[model samples]
Target: MNNWKPRVSMGIPVYNGENFLREVLDSLLAQTFEDFELIISDNASSDRTEEICRSYAAKDKRIRYHRQEINRGPAWNFNRVFELAQGEYFKWVAHDDIYAPEFLAKCVEVLDRDDSVVLCYAKTKFIDSEGKILKEYDYQIATDSPQPAERYRSLVLVNHRKHAAVEIFGLIRSDALKKTPLLGYYARGDSVLLVRLSLLGRFYEIPEYLFFNRDHSQRSVKEKQVQIARGRTIVAKFLGMGPLPPTEWFDPSRKGKIDFPEWRLFYEYFISVKSFPLAVKEQISCYLYLGYWLFKNWMKLVRDLLIAAEQLVRASYKAQKIIEISLEKRF
Candidate 1:
C-alpha cells in the first residue's frame, strides 16, 4: 500500500443512518476540494447502514468504512473516527447533513491561510428531513474573537442562538482537537468541545451558507433528549428543553450509573478552563463567566442532584428486594 495522507479528514459517526446517508456521501464526494479522506464509523447498525457504507467504500479510494461488532455508543464512535484520521485537518459531519460543493474548499483555504484559526465553519441553514430548507441560522457567536475568554463566554451562551452545536462540525486543527478531551460521554459535550477548541485558538466563520443541518424527529438529540426533562440539555435548554439522555446513549459502560448531565456539563466546563493555560486575567474572566453560567443553570444543576438521589433510592430498593427473594428461597 502507499503511504498517502489527505489534507483533511472528514469523520462520520453514524448509527442506522441509511435513510439520508446517500445524500451526505454524495455531497461530500462532490466537494470542490477532492484531497480529503472520508472515514465512517458504523455503530453496529442493524439497518442497511453497513451495506451502504461498503458500497461507497468500494467505489472511492478516499472512503474508509468500519463496523463495530456491537454498539459502542456515540462517544466511542465519534472518537474512533478521529483516532483513525491521519490528515492535517479534521471535520466531523453528521450522516444526515448536506454540504455545498465549496464547503471543504472554503474551510481548507481559511485554515491554510490563517495559522491562528483553529477551526473554520460556514454559515448554516437548517433543513427538514425531506431536504427542504426550514430556516437559516444567522446568529454568529464571537468565536472569531481574538480573546480566548470572550470566545469561551460566547460559546457558553450558544444556546441563545436557538441552534445546535454546528460549529463542532467545522474544519479544525487536528493538533488543537487532540489537546482537549475529544467529546466527552456526557450531555452537551459537543459544546464543551467547541469551547475548549476556542481556548486553543481562534474560530473563523465563513460568511456564506455552505452547510446544511438536517433536523429530523429521529435524530439522536431530538429522540433521546425528549426522554429527559424538556429544555434542560444544552441543545434544548434555550427552548426550555429537556435534560440529559439516559445511560448507554454516550457510553454503554456507564449503564445504570446516575447521570447528572447539567452538573456534568458544569464540571466539564471548569475542567476545560483548568486544563488550558490562560493569562491570569483571562482565567479569572472565564471563572467569572462560569459564575454567571452557574446562576443561570442553577435550576438544572439542582435537578441533576435530585435525579441522582432518586436513582440511588430506586437502586437500593431493587437490591433489597432481590436479596430478600434469595433468602426466602434458601429457607
Candidate 2:
C-alpha cells in the first residue's frame, strides 16, 4: 500500500515448490519498487505451496493468490498468470529463482524511458537449490558483436535455446506479449516467444546483475528425454518439407554437444522458407547442423531408402520361389 505508481505485474507460478517458497516471497517483498502487484498461481501443488502463498497473501494487500483445481504444467500455469495480469509491463518469476532488491526498479526505469524496447533482461547468476551462488550468465547473448538483427539471425537460425537466456524473469511489454499466443508449442516455448518479440522490435539489454536462475536436477529437460527429443519434430513441423536447396547448413556452437537433433531441426525449420536467397543461406546453415545431428546416422535417410528397396527385391524373389514349388507339386 505504498504511495507509488504501479508499473509492473509480476507473475509467479508454483508447483510443489515448498522448500524455497518462503525465500522467494521474501525477496519479492523486499523489492525497492513497492508499486508492483504480485500474482501467484498455484498449480494444485500437493506440497505446502498453498499454505505459503496464502500466508503471504494475508500480509500483502497487493498480492493476489489463486489455486487451480488441476495441475496444468508450467506453460499453462505461466500463461494463466499472464492472462490475469493488469500492469503495463509483465515479468514472470519461477518458483525457485530469486531476484535482486532493485531488479524490478531498474527494469521499470528503462521501460518507462523507452517506448521502443519490447523486452528487457539483465545478467543472471546461477544458483543451487539452497540459494548458493554458482556462476554468472553474463557472456551468453549479451556481447554478440553484430547488430541486433544479425545477432538475432545467427542465434535463431542455429536454434540457440540453451545458449539464450531463460525467459523466466525478463520484463516484457504486456501489449507486445499479448500479441503472440503463449504455450502452444511443445519445447522451447520461451525461445519461440523471444524470437517472435524480436521480430517486432529491439530488445533492451541491462548489463547489470539483477536476477538469479536456479539449476536443479528435477528440471523438465532432465526428466523427459523423449519429450526433449521430440523438440526436433516440432522444429521440423515448422520448417516444412521442400526441395531445391543443397547449400544451406547449420553451424551449431561447438562448445556444447547437447541436443544435436534440435540443432538440425533448427536448420530444417529455416530451410522451409520460400524465399530463394534465405532458402540458400538457411540450407547451408542446416547442413552444418546436419553434420552434427546426423553424424553417425549421416546416411540414415539414404540407408532407410536402400533397406526398403532390398526388402522389395527379397519379397519378389520369395514369391517366385513359392510359384515354382507349387508348379512342381501340381505336375
Candidate 3:
C-alpha cells in the first residue's frame, strides 16, 4: 500500500447527512483504488455527520475531514472541496450517493489513458433511501464528442433532459477546474461550469452503471427550479446570435460589444450587417423557441392554477361542513 500512487482525489461534500454518511464513506474505503485520498468537507452539519467523519478520519489516514465554521451552502462547499483538492484528477461524490467498487479505478484509467478527454461520466443507477435496487438510468448519456458548436447546440436543446450534474462523474483535470471556479450562480452554474470544462477539452462516457443516485422527497426543489431558469438563460444567450459581452459587464479592454465565440454568439451578427436570410433564421429559431416555451409554461401555469382552485374549493367545503355539524349539535 505504501507503493500505491494516489492519482485521484475523491471529494465528498456533506451537510447533515448523518443517516447515509457512514454508508458512503464505507463504500469509498472499500473501493478497489486504495491509493486515493478521500477529502470529506463537512459544511457545518448540525447532526452526527461531523462525528462520523471524524471517526473515519481517525480510522483511515487517507480520509481528510474538514468542517466549515459556517454553512457555505452546497455550491460553495463543493467549490471549497475542489479548490482544496491536491490530486491530478478530482471527482465529486455526493454525501447521499454510493459508488460501485471499480468506479474510481475505471475513471482514473480513462483519464490516465486519454490526454484529450477532460471529462468522463458513466450511467447511474437510481436507488431508494434504503439502498434498494430501483432502476438503471442511462437516458443522459451523450455518445459523441461533437465540435464545440454542436456541443452547445445539443446542450441548449437537451441538457436538462440529461442526468444530475451533482453526481459529477467525470475525472476532472485539476488544472482545468481551477480556471473555472464554481461561483454560486442562481441556476445552471453546473451547466455553465460544464461549458467551461468542455471548452478545456473533450468528454468521454463510461459504458457502465458505476454510480448510485438516491431519489427521495428531501431533494431541493428550489435549487432545481433555479438550475432550470439559469439553463434557459444560458441557452438563450448562446442562441441569441450576437457576440457575447465580456464575462461580465464590469470588465473593460474589449468594452461595449466585442465579437463572441461563433459557437455561442447570438443572431445579432446578421442583423447588425443586414444579411436577410441569416438574420431571418436567427429570428425564426429564437422566436419559435420563445413562443413554444411561453405557450408551454402558460399551459402548465393554467393547470397548476386549476389544481389550486380545486384544492381551495375542497378545503372550503370541508370547513363549511364542520361549521354546519357544530350548529346542528347545538340546536
Error of 2 at 7 (Å): 1.7
Please, what are the lDDT tens digits per residue for candidate 3 over residues 53-129?
99999999888899998876666777778777778888888888888888888878888888877777767788888
Order of models, best TM-score first:
1, 2, 3
How many backbone clashes does every candidate have? 8, 15, 7
Candidate 3 lDDT trough over 10 residues, lowest sum: 263-272
Quality of model 2 by C-alpha lDDT: 0.64
Comparing 1 with 2 on lDDT, the higher-scoring candidate is 1
lDDT against true structure, model 3? 0.63
TM-score of each: 0.93, 0.67, 0.66
- Give the Å shift of residue 251 in candidate 2: 31
* Candidates sorted on lDDT, descending: 1, 2, 3
Which of the two, 1 or 3, has more lDDT? Answer: 1
Model 2 agreement with the true structure over 93-202: per-residue lDDT tens digits: 88788888998888888888877677777888899887788887754542132233433454454434347446436888999888666543234556556655654445
lDDT of every predicted structure (CA atoms): 0.87, 0.64, 0.63
lDDT, residue 9, model 1? 98
Residue lDDT tens for model 1, 1-331: 8899899999999999999999999999999999999999999999999999999999999999999989888889999999999999999989999999999999999999999999999999999999999999877688889999999999886664375788999999999988988988876778889889999999999999999999888877633554664334343444464556764567779776767778778888898888989999999999899999999989878776666666688689999999999999999
